[model samples]
Target: MSWSIKNWRRNQILQREGIPDYIWQKLISMRCLKGLNPDELMRLRECATLFLHDKQINGAHELEITDEMRASIALQACILILNLDLDYYRNWVEIIVYPGEFILDYDYADEFGVVHHIHRIAAGEAWSAGPVILSWQDTIHTATRSGHNVVIHEFAHKIDMLHEGANGCPELHANMSAYTWHEVFSQAYAQFCHQVDKRQETIIDPYAAESPAEFFAVLSEVFFELPLITQQHFPSVYEQLALFYRQDPAQRWR
Candidate 1:
């Protein structure tokens, strides 16, 4: 059957009903939902239905993944789909959750073939064609409007990867001019790097300087979290992001 707002409420990710009021309240209160409005909420709910229907969410470690947990994650994750589409997340199948901040082991090789031990802490990750991993602790606190959402960031990566590997460039709509995207983004990315090298604070996070992909993800977070601020500081980058995401968040969020 075709997915639509008309039939969305009739569907649920889980058949086990009795969803708590608090869960609904949290979802309803989310800023991302606000951009959707009441009518759009219905469509977003349908996208959530599809997300829950297709994706398998797993609770890693000792975490007890509850209905609320799934619902909360689905509600926000699907909003990107509400505007874009489900195929945006084509590569991943699971939303793995660790109870708290999980440790990731990294190995670095030297000229002498010596391996260096490296550990890193992350709130969430978007693997290429792999499942998205997130920390429940960070996930729970990551309010949709805070300009720092792991789900949106990871999903944005998925969108960026659709064209090829996420070099911060995605398949833009036909109406969009490619050269404008390149001109704006190149200037902004370069300026952002210069500031980062000087250890200077920027309106857009300097973490964006880490890589083109990271710039996309970090700016994506700020796009929704602080759309007004992002547009104000980096209007060029903001326009490009608005074009790619297909949403005028600076306007909607305002």
Candidate 2:
């Protein structure tokens, strides 16, 4: 879409289908959204409104979707792109929400190029150029936990995939250094993996150790929900994320 056409559509959505004031207020008051100034809050609201207009959020497995549920999911999803652009989330529209954890049965190739069939439970999953599947139960509750938000985690993957394939690096801005991003995240990922391998307790989720992609996604959850922790433990990584997302969440938290 051309910039002019997109801007016009966004304006129309903002004027015609704005979220109710009460719902918007409630969403902004959430812990994950803390420290947003009035202007940032307004921009976030606009982005979220456009997000809801663009994306299709559906309930699965007999789960009924509600307006509040939709707003809740949209608000969190928009937070990732609040400082960026809604186009960051383009090419995907469906957000499937289940009542709770869902079964994921699929085949995958490991490092050895051997294919394996695996069945497991997942709270959320984001596909490249595809739908974002989430467990609604985890979505609402995990936000309150220390940097454990399923919505943010999955959506972060969506953003990461925008670059090359969610390998812990996304498309960088012109001013941002790709080399710095790689170095910082690679070191952080290695340290985090070692800690997890030793079974040490970590404020960041151990799931990050799974891969570079997961490390980026999981840390993104912490970066938004618990900025202080992210800044404290992995300062360089936090700096890189701040540059990429174009938001100073740590400063906001402070």
Candidate 3:
């Protein structure tokens, strides 16, 4: 429907049931929401409320999902889509939260057709047209730490999967060029991988060198957390992300 209809519905719902003071306090304490203006904050709250209405933030591993936890997760997830719309996340409906890192055991075949079973631990995962799973511990650590945010990382994958698969590129705006995104990200990813190979100290996460898709997801964490560093290190990618996400987080932090 239209923006006005969505806004009116959100307002009506918010009027009846609003965010609690304690939950808002926890969100402010996280520091990521610090520089948002009053209007932005209000919109964020509205977005978060609609998120709660649309998606299920359920706790796994017998972990009790509290209202505070729901609000906190919604606040973080909504921040990424503040300038975008809820429609961007249309495919996802469930957010599974675990107490800590979880393990997944699966089997895969090699080129020789040899079957191998492996177990891997993951902090968060976003399956195309499926749920976004996260670890509550890692999610909380993002508030105090730099260069980390599983929520943003996984959500970035969802954004990347919008057009197709998560291939380091999200659906670019009319102003953004596919050639520019490819040229910039390819060069930066190669350079970062070189630095990682040499075991040099780097500002961006070394895990970013894993693949183009992971690079995109990891840089998304840095884009929201250490905006200055991301901009300073990879100016072109930062510009593209700023254009796509439609937020100058560096300016917000400043």
Model 2 lDDT per residue over 104-178, tens place: 999978669999997999999998889999998898897457689899999999998988777889999999988
185-216 per-residue lDDT for model 3 (tens digits) = 99989999999999999888788988899999
- Using all chains and alpha carbons, the TM-scores for the candidates as numbered come to 0.84, 0.94, 0.91
Best of the two (2, 3) by TM-score: 2
Flag regions of model 1 displaced more than 4 Å: 1-22, 106-118, 144-146
Worst 10 residues of 3 by lDDT: 25-34
Superposed on all Cα atoms, model 3 deviates from the true structure by an RMSD in Å of 2.6
lDDT of 3: 0.87
What global local distance difference test value does model 1 have? Answer: 0.76
Best model per TM-score:
2
lDDT tens per residue, model 1, 1-254: 55575356445443334334577776767665666577777666666766777788898887888878898888867766677788877866888989887887878575599999968888787767788888888777877335677777777787787787778888888888888987888888898899989888777656689888888888887777778888998888888777766778667776
Off by over 4 Å in 2: 1-6, 109-113
